[model samples]
Target: MPVTDVTTDPEQLTMTLTAEFEASVDRLWQVFSDPRQLERFWGPPTWPATFTSFDARPGGHAEYHMTGPKGERSSGRWEFLSIEAPRRFEVIDSFMGDDGAPLEGFPSMRMTFEFEADGSRARLRNTTYFDSAEALEQVVAMGAVEGSTTAMNQLDRVLTGLREYAQGKGTRVEELSDTLVRITRLIDGPRDLVWQAHNDPELMRQWMLGPDGWTMTACEPSQTVGDSYRYAWAPLEGTEGESFGFEGEVLVVDPPRRVVTTERMAGTDGPSTINDSVFEEEDGATLVILHIEYPDRETRDMILATGMAEGMEASYARLETVLAE
Candidate 1:
């Protein structure tokens, strides 16, 4: 019945998550490090938060304030533990009452964020360590699972935005629920250039989103259908993201022509329906089509509403530049 980590140690209730973005580690860090960038997606869309003093440095303090239904308010603070400059961080978090007083019975916890990269992707991990078993249980009971879910939801938007921004431009957009989002763009470059950027870590750093302070752990093609590759990304963004191990299965690989693979993240197994990346030739350029799908109506509509279409369009523009270079 756990939320984040749906698989092993469900009873443990401890969580870790990792995800690869279509942008670079530095771009992702900018979003996480800058408070202004989070203003649009820092909390639930319906019930967002207004943060204060998000100083992200060693020994710096951070705080968030929120007011849910019926005038309910929640505030918290964290004491900066250590910083590795855009890569890793440790901090303690605890809920506080409106009067700036820590909740009497709640347990304080320490959390860490770590990031790594793989080819055109980045792996990130966010791990939380509680002082004791009872402490962990108490926080879980208090709804850290769903709370983190909302946080990650906002996180997804931010990371996705940074990806678009890094590519130099982005637009707020969505696709029709029934209409498959077949995104195609022409990049005026050699086929090998596009393929290399997609397959090489050094080249990937120029155009993909990854964990903050990320490093490439592994990169290789899948040998057979259903054959999987593993890459360890720590300080998971959430339990589901962590389970995917920042790795996925290669369903189909045709080299520079086309590559089909499954993406893993903190989720419930068997990879979501998201699939497809194809490259074709057009007039003096390479036409790339990226088609990603969601399983159901509700999720598709939700994703569409998030304005990812515009973001993708912008990202593709940047990809063109990377490929051209």
Candidate 2:
């Protein structure tokens, strides 16, 4: 992770975060200056930020909202106070309501972001000054530390090109928290084709099989929000394992880009997980990121212990072959 330290001081009424990156100071500055790039890692994986409006100059302000898995949104705005190219910038950050006004009863904070060169690397120091200790404590109690850490750690991937960062990495899984896991893989195909492969039954049957001995017996994919999908697999005649399946309801579908669903074991009363899958295309290839939020820590552990990552990797490898064909 890029984030190194996070500290809060009651006496000073401030919180500070320090992170180091392998990129140069100029590169680090560009990421913050560009709203598109900034939104990519400004929020945690579960709630990704979308910048509705961004003006980077001093005296300018930016409006953005982070959307949660269940389609809930939390809006925020930043008023740029000062800007020093490739070095530092300052802003006043405030919570906003749906009417585009700063929300009442919410404390606004002054934030300063400083970038410095560190001999072929860069260091970022972000300090937020609050009006009172109560305000500082409030944000901390709201999981600010963990949220900021996870948000900053994502900068590493944003800083690198998609292909350079994900290609050849195969299917990688990261346990973000007790109940959240992230799975990522690079598909050697366009985003549209990759999306089609997931939604088309004929295409899915070609590669969605977890292991060589298993065959997809049924695939009913959801095409719209509120629709339910079911997939079942059974071992080949000579194979050993019994039949199993999964069912899920589509919650959100932004074709070729993102899809959110609630997934559970087909016939069981097991807890369901919210799966948010995002696809981004770069250089004729697609990067697939799946963020799964389990119902509990035990559920997360049990699912991961079933060699889920390895199974997904096998399926993804097969998808690459299918795409080539």
Candidate 3:
């Protein structure tokens, strides 16, 4: 709606819009718990005023009435297709005639929402599915596709505002999968600066937040194939330290070309849920690749949809600034 580029393939139509909220994901979740908040943004300006009878539960109803631009009112019922509490919600939306009349032709859509987070970053992805290609084509023709995207973009803005409003909130990410997120930066400085920034705790403290305001407490090399160490975090003063351990066999540590740590960040050690970081030279700069491999499939999908990328990007900016200072 705001002239954003739309990229489509045979499988999906991808429209990405970003907003940086100072509030955490946990705070954002509360804002969506109410139906009133939802309808305020879900309606189009041309659609006449509306109200919703929402049962925000599994197998419940989310019914509403809409006044068209021409003053024609229409009614519809949406049944909750699936739900995973505060993390995910899926619904089957069906349109009907003005009264309790028989159904007309409108694609039945399965809409889903997924939540993910990094230290201070959070991502939420909404995906909807149509039964078939003809169904999709029909909706596109009726302008439903574009209209829905507009609604989702509005929803994004609402969530972002909620997040920024509650800055006192601490970071608590519900990652569906292992590590669930990655951290990487496109550094313009020389190789030494990039490498040192990653390895130095002070530089990391400028960006990566551990648990509560905790920074990296300790990191040591037990280096070799199948060797690793533990890092501790103390977010608040007078709190006991929390430690997470990693033991990884070196896959590659060829200096500037790349460095790989089989280190797992979300689950028990071993190759189970490993994180790999790679650095490559690009015009005297470095293109860093940060990847997290999780053991679960569902978690993987949820994590990818969450706003991890944007969070990582922001931290990278901080890292560069810290190095320059």
Candidate 4:
């Protein structure tokens, strides 16, 4: 419930709303990029939005409908004009038909969102332009001002919950040596549950995807020493036959305590790495320590350069949701 400033200027033919969040810019960007996350805070308290389709790139289109408490529905669409990744985007927002087509004679608003980074916090400025002063007043009369303010107010709660989960899994990476990196976290779950979530393919798919738009096509984990596990990922929007493979052999398997494995990134032709994972519990919270050893320093550095920390943190945040479920 911070400052949610909403201003409507008929002279400028625009309605602008500015708000700040306690999360990082990247985290705030995810809420806009990921449709699943966007649905959580895109509507007022009495009316929750459900996105039927969403694509967060330039030239993409989004269709969603918000249902009222009395079963009334309001459908909308967004035609993205430009995108600057985690910083800003412009879209044409309008009322839509059930077939996902723009309705004729309807007043459309051009919305621009700018996300500014302020250290760990972020500031979001949104401006919605109308064709004329009358056009703006027409929508404002339909409750656009109140609905937007309410939706923006819900963002803090959604972002706070995500941050709390990420904090619980205190995931951090330490470069122990040239060829080795240590990743440690205190996961808010029991040891047995954590171990099962890691070894179970169905559970692994729920959280293993990083920030990419890829989906885990396959997860075959053999929970025994000398057995092999194969995990495959392909872009959710990619063409057929394009995929990345990761295969590993279980060297040691001690359930709820330790596991040793060797992993090779098949598509990248990257050097294989040996991973040793240990789990310890205190006060019903499991502490997970993972050591990844590469063949050489260059190999380890190369992987780290690909923003592995951010990707792993995103994955772990999803893992937190899984554990809570």
Candidate 5:
């Protein structure tokens, strides 16, 4: 187990757990900043977590549920209180009901995580403060210690696998659930430049073209929430493909960090998909992680069957060239 020690103070109504890892402090921080990585080890062995929404910033909130082997689910929410990149973060953690509200009679706690470099490795100090001793005791009795220990132990595999999983992979797709899919690509550029390439019409027109022999004919991008944007593409002369386009309304925008939008094919009344894209910088490269929620399983499968991942890879490869220029 990575947990080196676990201590509790009844008088202070607090519990603290210390753990060490063979990864750098920055690498350790990525696991928390990226929801995809956070879900990998946030729950115990038999109960795996799935984060439907994660916004890792002060005042932002995250919602997740851990599903047990028997299909039972335990939902939770986190209200980010403070954050200091590669160092520390704090959140108000609460049990959530199926209706997405805090569960009554459940005690919420203020949890803080601190990370630091310890010689060649990294160390994490996680502390949880309860409202009272009773609250602390209640969680302990609910197997909090054991569950947390097992969860942290699973982090080793995740930390070790991240680099090999994404470093050179052009564009990777993962089916997070029946309706949700995640696509990630590490672009060789800074976060701000990558964000500009996505939002700036001229820059977008340069690289958003999915495959060779295709041109972006129209690029109307939405810059504000509630506003709609449209993009159209056409095959170059003699190329075999039909012209098509997509339209979407922007729901949320945090410049150079995250954006949420609802997308659907233009000129069609098909069900729309919610797309949440996040940008994070690691070692000077920006990683683009997109979570796409389709209306149903059929829609998700149909989109994937259309060779979406392959097309995205081609676009991303072109994006790198644009960035280099």
Candidate 6:
């Protein structure tokens, strides 16, 4: 899935969302540059959007209207502030009137979109800055979180189509058995870089995090067979938790090739889940195949119900950002 995280901080007067795509940075950037593609996923599925004008360069403008299922239209405008092709851009987003003028006395936000590349994968982070806490709360109260999440979900589907079209191959998620789930994707990076990103502690810390404001405070990766590793995560403040983390034992380690490990969740004495990651290089990109095996069907279903896929997607997205740097 493309969208992995969406967060709102009233005190900070900001909202941030992150997404991952199975495409190169330049390819993923087109979704924002091309008005037609932007409109396709810019709004919630229930509210289709149409763009009147779009100029992606700095000092350019974009205007669009999203029509609700009931035929109500919400007009929006973006005044581009800065632009860096295939990487980052900033704009001021505001409500607009039928005359293409920004509405007064309404919340206008400073929005920045950063596109980061990881081999053949891309990560996008959007940060929206509000004028004040009240302004931030206003949008949150207006269902911005729920709406953005839905819209981003639609973006993921659109990205999948783009990936399939570009590579002539589609990513896959399969339920191999009652207790196993398999995920496969072709990433545009050499096998060595992909392997290093997973094995190196510093590189792992860069992307193996949960979401915004959450970090992997401790990381110990033993890349050799029969070794153990531990990683701990610190949650955002006031999130009703002290800290939670996980540990695992490495079973097999083959450089730039494959790794097998059994992950054990902290605070739980349940069966440890086994993970096998295989990397294959074709041309210049790497094909990643990951198999996750649970102890039983009930355990697999329970973890799936917890939305683990989103967290995994977020982690992978962060990895893209790290790789880009």
Best by TM-score: 2
Better of 4 and 5 by lDDT: 5
User: Worst 10-residue stretch by lDDT in candidate 5?
Assistant: 157-166
Top lDDT hit: 2
List the RMSD of every prediction in angstroms: 19.6, 1.6, 19.4, 20.4, 9.6, 18.9
What TM-score does candidate 5 get on C-alpha atoms? 0.61
Residue lDDT tens for model 4, 133-154: 8899998998888788867875
lDDT of 2 by residue, 167-225 (tens): 99999998988999999999999999999999999999999999789999999998788
Q: Model 5: per-residue lDDT, tens digit, 1-325? A: 5889988899888899999999999999999999988986798754667799998889999999986533468999999999999899999999999998899988999999999999989999999999988899999998998888878976875787644547787788878669878788988888999999999999999899998999998899986888999999999998998999999888767687667788899998878998877676756788787878899999999999998898899999999999999
Model 2 misplacement above 4 A: none
Ranking by TM-score: 2, 5, 4, 6, 1, 3
Listed in order, each prediction's TM-score against the native is: 0.46, 0.95, 0.42, 0.51, 0.61, 0.50
Worst 10 residues of 6 by lDDT: 162-171
By lDDT, the candidates rank as 2, 5, 4, 6, 1, 3
Instruction: For each of the candidates, give the backbone clash count.
Output: 24, 0, 5, 0, 0, 2
Alpha-carbon lDDT of model 4: 0.79
Where does candidate 5 stray beyond 4 Å?
1-106, 110-165
Off by over 4 Å in 3: 1-23, 160-325
Instruction: Assess the local accuracy of residue 134 in candidate 1 as a C-alpha lDDT between 0 and 100.
Output: 75
Better of 5 and 6 by TM-score: 5
Error of 4 at 202 (Å): 29
| Deviation from native of the Cα of residue 310 in model 5, angstroms | 0.8
Residues 1-325, model 3: lDDT tens digits: 2223333333663322323333466655555556655654465433322446878777888777665422356677778877676566777777767665536776566766665565675555655566777776776677664565544444543455432422223222334224344343456566777877766656665655433344555555433445564544445666555554444555444454345555544345333545555454434555554556666766566655755565455556666567677
